[model samples]
Target: MSFYSDDASADELETLGWYHYDLSRHTAEALLLSNGTNGSYLLRNSNEGAGFFALSVRAKDSVKHFHVTRKGNGYVFGFNEFPTLQHFVNHFANQPLLGSDAGTLMVLKSPYPWRVEEPSIYESVRVHTAIQTGRTENDLMPSAPSLGTKEGYLVKQGAIVKNWKQRWFTLNRYELKYFKEKACEEPIRTLDLRACSAVQFDYSQDRVNCFCLVFPDRTFYLCAKTGVEADEWIKILRWKLPAVTLSVSSHR
Candidate 1:
């Protein structure tokens, strides 16, 4: 069964305007959230397995704008306000240009070996994991025994896809393939959604949607939905997590 089967009811497909892909070590989860208002999509990868990366796209004056972020380390890349290509070049000198086609451009870092490409307006910005250290055994499997639902989360596993000494830990062999497969999914073809904010509040009906999760080192807000009722949904999510946390934690 699909991971979203049980929580399908909780998800309002119509409200999910654009497509967002969450790729971890084990599985890739996609969601259509809000419209393309906030951004085209938000992409995340798992740090435990390897790490996470995200892309946000927005439209400006008929041209699509892109923003890319790496979750844990917080590396951000996007177009600058410079008017000419030379301006972009002067700033990021060490990076090598990957490709430029159909009004889109691609670049890569020869050192970290990262790939940055823009495929389209609504579908702009793609980031591939780089081999920081050397190669290692890498594999992608279900995070847990069972699939996860929107209501239930899953833990995925990544190990050596194949056995080899030199190519074992090299992220280029397996990790890149995994990320591309997850990122290459067809982006939602609409333009009416936005990203849910990390923090939000609603004044109507005397209720507020404030949700926060405290990891050992950091805190995250999992609430905030897309569109007009986003604030309200944030409140609902805030109230829900405490109970949900206990339930999920106990099981873990």
Candidate 2:
């Protein structure tokens, strides 16, 4: 299934890069909120049921997932029905979508770019579902737990002195540990992911490609080699966090 619906053609799949088949609701929201600007959106299969789809859009400060259901021969979004998904997208591109609130409005500004090198959508969906349900993916799929690990070089700000120093960072399980060297046996510091309140992009520093891991007591500032590297770290770290932390993190 290249697209959400089997009726959608291969041609449509090639043209509609916004259609993310089998993407879980939680994963979709994370992608939009972490990487997209306001009004960025994507379409995906709805968790509600088959033959249903979702419109995940980046709103003012949060990501909203709107239900898209079949209405006879057309597609229904909010109060309107369109002959096709393209028509629905075209209409929303120009018009504002009213939220549940009286005055809240959301518009589709841009489609979040779909990348070819993304990790398995199945694995992402599994992890997201596990987090939401408070169960390990092993329970869901009867496979070995696949908690991911990421290792890279990043500049870290000293907690007390505030001086920046380069370190080898490794994110595994529920902890982010930084080592003095890539092959070092001991980590210089370990930031517990459970204690982490949020992870977000920070530009307050003079250095470029900066992001921070927010703890209740203090924040750890880190700079990657490039913007793409920084985004990768942020996304993986966010995924490994607990559901409550993720919910809080997304609102920021």
Candidate 3:
């Protein structure tokens, strides 16, 4: 690899320019690179280790994701092991064969330029202000450990682009974990209730069903699928950090 990062090894496989889909220009959370005309792409995620790569190809009408890992300056994709990146690159180097890749062929070759921000959940969700007297919620609420789970899409800050992207969220106990897709076993990132600076309900008034998780370093702008879900998540977060204020929407 060509200097993936400090953690990456120089002796490993060939490098591909991974195009990031995020709006942020800082971090490299998602990397995708394609020939533009070809549907195939070389992918990498900063959230994942440097050892892994996702090779996506378009076959017929369906797109496929193939898991590959770096091995001794070579690549092991799916079940086949290539001794060098050149061999793997050669396997899919044919122009006709590359055109079939689904991931990039359309996006790169489309007539219309792709727009990242459209009218979506980020626009639909509204944040409310808290009605608490002080910075603390009363002790009468249930604890974070008892809050259980909530399923929704959360607006997450991008690692590279510094923009926000919607991620599938699961609120379990004192933890909030977000994933690239629903039902994924591994989370892209997890937030600790114990480490949070404060949990504010509806801290931003622009969005409905919106809640904010405050931390010393950063803040999470999250919105539940519904107001009830947002309230429940805030209620649970308050229990974990008792001093955190409870926010109630004026509409509710």
What is the model-wide C-alpha lDDT for candidate 2?
0.76
Candidate 3 lDDT, tens digit per residue, 1-252?
243553444433323334232223122112122222235343443234666665544333444455667777677865678887678656555432233233343322221122233545554333323333443444334342444555567666565666667889876666778999887889998888766766666645476677787787877777666777677777666656533333332234
Q: Give me the runs in candidate 2 sitting further than 4 Å from their true place.
A: 1-146, 249-252
Candidate 3 clash figure, as a count: 21
Which scores greater on TM-score, model 1 or model 2? 2
The alpha-carbon lDDT assigned to residue 18 of candidate 2 equals: 81
**TM-score on alpha carbons, each prediction:** 0.16, 0.43, 0.35
- Please give, for residues 1-252, the per-residue lDDT of candidate 2 as tens digits: 643355544445446678787888888888887788888988887767755788888887888878888654458887788887578667866856557554567777888766646655554321232233666654643221126677789999998898999999877677789998898999988888877877889989888999998888998899999998899888878766667665675688
lDDT of 3: 0.54
Residues 110-208 of candidate 1 have per-residue lDDT tens digits of 111112244556843222222334534232121110111111111112223322111111111111111112234442211111111122442332223
By summed lDDT, the worst window of 10 consecutive residues in model 3 runs over 23-32
Per-residue error at 206 for model 1, in Å?
A: 55
Candidate with the larger lDDT of 1 and 3: 3
If the candidates were sorted by their TM-score against the true structure, best first, what order would they fall in? 2, 3, 1
How high is the CA lDDT of each candidate model? Answer: 0.28, 0.76, 0.54
